[model samples]
Target chain A: MSDIKARVSFLGKSANILIWLLLIGACAFVVTPLLFMFSASFMPAIDIMKLPYPWVSDHIHRQNYWNGLRGPDGSFVFLRNTLNSLIVALAVTITTVLLSSLSGYGLAKFRFKGRNAVFMLIMATMMIPFETIMIPLYMVSMKMGLQDSYAGLIVPFLTNAFGVFLMRQFLLTFPDEVLDAARIDGASEPRIFTHIVLPNSGPAIATLAILTFRSQWDNLLWPLLVVQSDEMKTIPLYITKFMAETHSDEGIMMAVAAMASLPMFILFFTMSKYFISTEGLHSTIKG
Target chain B: MQYNKRFSMEQKKAVWGWIFVAPSLLFFLVFSFYPIFNAIYMSFFKKNLLSLKPPEFVGWGNYVYLFHSKTFWQSVSNTAVFTIGTFIPLVVFSLMLAVFIVSRPRFQKFFQMALYSPAALSSVVAALIWLLIFDPRGLANQTLNTLMRTSGVNYHWLSSSSMLRLSTIIVYFWKYVGYFTVVFVAGIGGIPDYLHEAALIDGADSWKDFWHITFPLLKPTTLLVSVMVMIQCLKTFSTQYLFSTSGAPTRPIDVITLSIYNTAIKDHNIGRASAMSVLLFLVMLILTWLQLRIAKTEDVTYN
Candidate 1:
């Protein structure tokens, strides 16, 4: 009995070691390409293409960033594109948070006729892929003279059904007695929302805001259709253009990719807890 | 007087509800509902994107043309190949990765953060990074050559038909595997601890306990992940688009969305593009409905 127990303990120890090894390997697999991108961003183009490809640069070359940002004619096209992406993403995020919270509150708390029908309508649209409707949407944008402008990008995606769903699921569990007390104290519905609902909805708002911002920042298909001019191009388009013009220079392409991904990385690192939260994941999948 | 006052209060609440939901409803009506209906309507008309003339009605012409077109069929097959090749491996490996992460409580957060790093990248950025890796004299070939003890043997990651398809799959898998793993981690976390304890008390080992208890309890999450993966794979556009534009052959990787993009933007064939989109929408709808039906039957509610 003593010998068998010793063998069992030894087997468990080996299994634990194997698990750690597997975890490290998986992490490395997920991270290596990113490491390569960062390393390549500072290397010369030739070094990047050399056999036994250079994992690190001998010297940190800042020239690639300068060249990548300043276009062939020295116009800061990449910077302008980054600004456009920021503006669109911020506008969409702010409006989506405010509007989604309002709708989510109303749908979750209040009793109203046609509420379910309205919700069903919105949820039905979530099933329809944006590609299926792009041609018509493009036509609509053209008719409204919204093509080639920020309004064209910002207006169409102000709020999505998924945000409302997330917010509603969150607000459903909110205590109604607080709102009732506020109402009994002569507070209007809007006042109750601004003062009571918004303050208490930190997690849901943060989750929705981050998701909205990331989606807008990374949006490619709709922007590709709406923005025609070089001036209105967003980061994705800018990167594509840079890749095309500087096909031979892997360093410059990597530089552009690194710069474009910086904001998302920062956002993810800061609010990652919300991203992997069981509540958020549960609501997202429960639908 | 009391009845009238209560009636007015209920009416006031209902009015406020409408006031709150109005803006989003209007936005969706114009942006989502209108476009979906309009796409279906426009599929019957022959319209040139650049032409100022009125659209000429040609009911079912575009659909018939698509059904017979070899390029459309090729795109269909390519999409099927991409979806099948990617989603199965994605579901399997991400689940495995999730199990590995969950098994080790100490490293769960660290492992999740590391795996989910790539999902934060935009599809364009993801593809751009992979493009460098897939270059002839890049990391992909170097690693393979070193592993196999071969010198300067090019794998043709971008040029060959099968490898090109595989390259796109690799990028997508690398980007999303962590995301779904995180989702799976959340799913597995939802399983109650008492069940595991009971299994252990019954002399069931970890493997048997997982197969009999955790896997069955995780049915809803698995269905959700599979459907989400399927839908996302069907809608894959940017990677294939970027690869084709970067001089890789378009024929092998031209999925439906990319084909729709080319038809609309390159060829200026609005009617044809609308028809293709409608067909794609039907596929998504059918898949979503199928999932819902299966979910209804297989739902495992905890008492």
Candidate 2:
């Protein structure tokens, strides 16, 4: 009986240790790729492919960043792509935040015929995949002579259904009497919206802005189709093309890839609280 | 007299409503609603993109051709395989991870951040990073060799068919599991604590409490995650696209989206591609409806 007790105690301790080890291991597995990309970016070109896995680039070469910034055929073209991504993402974020808040406030506070139907219209189309619409969107853009332009790139995705839904739900939580009081004080609807609602809805606006910016920043297939010229390519397009062009220079390619991921790192770290759970984005829809 | 004045005020509010929703509504109408009908119209014709002549109306010819095409069927099967492989693991493991993370309150944010960061990466970069990992002399092979203690474990991830399918699934799994896990954590968090406390009072163990209370309560979330995973798996492209273009065997990794892309963009067969899109959309629509119906029936049985 004493031997049995001793065995059980040892087993319990081992199990506890094992569970902790597994948790840490799982976390490490989740993060390995980004770490590898960051480390390999700093590795020497020759050492990138060396055996035993250069997990953390022993001989760090800071010049890899410079080499990667150099586009195919010695043109500083990659810079243009990075700039294009930033411009599109920022534009989409600002437009989405403004439009969604106004529309959300209108639907929540103002009584109108067809409001529910309009909201339903947006919700029903929410799950429609972009692939189904890309071809026709491309065709329409071409017909309108908007292809390969910044307008084509940013216009279609300026606002989404989820944005409207999120803003409406958040604004619904705020008491409505504040706006009515503003109206009694001789303030116009637009003035009340701009001053009262917008100022109060900071967290919700940040949520929409972060989600919109992240999705736009990471957009690829649409950008690939819309922008044909190297001058107009976004970061994903430029890097993919650059990678295919210079397949041999991997250290440099990794460096470029790392640089491309900088916005994601920045956006994620800054807005991480908003992103910690889908509760921020999900629960509002049903509510 | 008072009633008439109130009616006028209601009319004014309606006008303001229109003003507020106008811009976003206009954007959606042109971009979303217009394309939906346009794609349907294009699917009936032999619309070759490079040709100047107007599309020749083929009616259901593109659909018939797709039905007879062997490669189309292959792509359907490939998508199914990838969906099943990735979907099950993602749903199961994300749920488990969510449950585990919730148990450890102190490290929830740590694990959450580590997992969620990958979701922020562009598919292009994520695929590139994985491409490096799966290289012949990369960490993946090195670890495999060391563990097996044998020198002859070459899986030929890019060249072989089964291996290529598995590789794409792995790429997607690594990218999205954390995202869905965070969603599940939020879902689980919403469950009232009293149910678990009651189970404990009744002498139910943790496992029993989870199975009886937590799992059943998380039905809506599980459904959402399952549906999302299914749709995303079906629509997968960038990684598969990069793989084929980067010299991997294209046939093995030819997902439906890739085929649609090849037909429309590369082959310039807009009619065929549009038809494929319509069919894929129908599949998605029907699958979602079926799942909802199944859930409804289950609720009847259980409740």
- Categorize the docking of model 1: medium
True contacts kept of each: 0.65, 0.49
lDDT of 2 at B34: 81
User: For model 1, what is the alpha-carbon lDDT of residue B171?
Assistant: 95
The residue-by-residue lDDT of candidate 1 on A1-287, one tens digit each, is 01211111213667768867877887888899999999999988988987777687787877988888886658998899999999999999999999888899889988899999988887777777777888888888999999999999999888888888778878999998998898889898999999999999998888888878887888889999999888999999888777777788888788889999999999888888877664324445322
Model 2 chain B is weakest, by summed lDDT over 10 consecutive residues, at B294-303
For model 1 chain B, give the 10-residue run with minimal summed lDDT.
B292-301
Give the alpha carbon lDDT tens digit for every residue of B55-151 in model 1: 9999999999999999999999999999999999999888888876787666678899999999999999999999989998888998889989998
- Report the lDDT of model 2 for residue B193: 67
> List-wise, what DockQ does each model earn?
0.50, 0.40
Question: Residue B132 in candidate 2 has what lDDT?
Answer: 81
